[model samples]
Target: MSHHIVLRVVAKLLIPLILLFALYVQFHGDFGPGGGFQAGVIFAAALILYALVFGLDSARRVISPDLLRVLMASGVLLYGGVGVASLLLGGHFLDYSVLASDPVAGQHLGILLVELGVGITVTSTMLSLFYGFAGRGGDG
Candidate 1:
């Protein structure tokens, strides 16, 4: 097959698997080697791969820089909000015990929220970086 044909085929086959692996990393983080940051990078890489083979314009349509900025800020806010909530509830920063009546359950919840924030921040940062490089005609 020609290079374009091969890339198209490979992208078609690989994207779903990449997304699945990212999800696995996001959810199975507590029990395995993967974690939020890794998962976010994995997810962003998959999208970046699409942009590499397809076009930056197409990728931008899917994930615009403005939206990415909001996402990045939202992630930070989420993490900070959790800490503030903990403090308001009469605990130190990120003290999960104040989040719920049951400390262990609160811990799980806190970890989940923090992991989600980390994942969002990581993914958006990487995507933005990819856009910066690729949009500058680095690939050419």
Candidate 2:
């Protein structure tokens, strides 16, 4: 990969667009054809493409394993926190209606937060898995 000049150049141009598209999928999911799962996979795939082109060390440096672990935990907490918030507001578990004074507003807010959490967790988990597997391969 280090020697693949064309690949390196193309990757440099494409990676940002890939990341941007992942973000678009994540945010637009509420209204359209994508969601946390799809967005997360795309996000992880972009990072992986970076790893494949620039080396795992570079990718790890860009997004550390330690940070990934923290993100994984935080994402779960974020999702759970939304549920707890709803409960505190006198709603049922995982209920979004009480999150805001207006039920519709609350539902929208809760769904967005929940989806963001899912996206983070999925992306981190996939990337972590990729790193684990990549680490086990030959030193070639």
Best by lDDT: 2
lDDT string for model 2 (1-140, tens) is 66999999999999999999999999999899998889999999999999999998899899999999999899899999999988888999889999888999989999899999999999999999998899789521
Clash count, predicted structure 2: 0
Residue pairs of candidate 2 with colliding backbone atoms: none
Residues 7-112 of candidate 1: C-alpha lDDT, one tens digit per residue: 8888979988998999899989988988889999999999988887777888788889999999989988999999999999999999977798999889988888
Who wins the TM-score comparison?
2
**Which residue ranges in model 2 land beyond 4 Å of their true spot?**
138-140
Report the alpha-carbon TM-score of model 1 versus the true structure: 0.93
Alpha-carbon deviation at 80 in model 1, angstroms: 0.9
Clashing pairs in 1: none
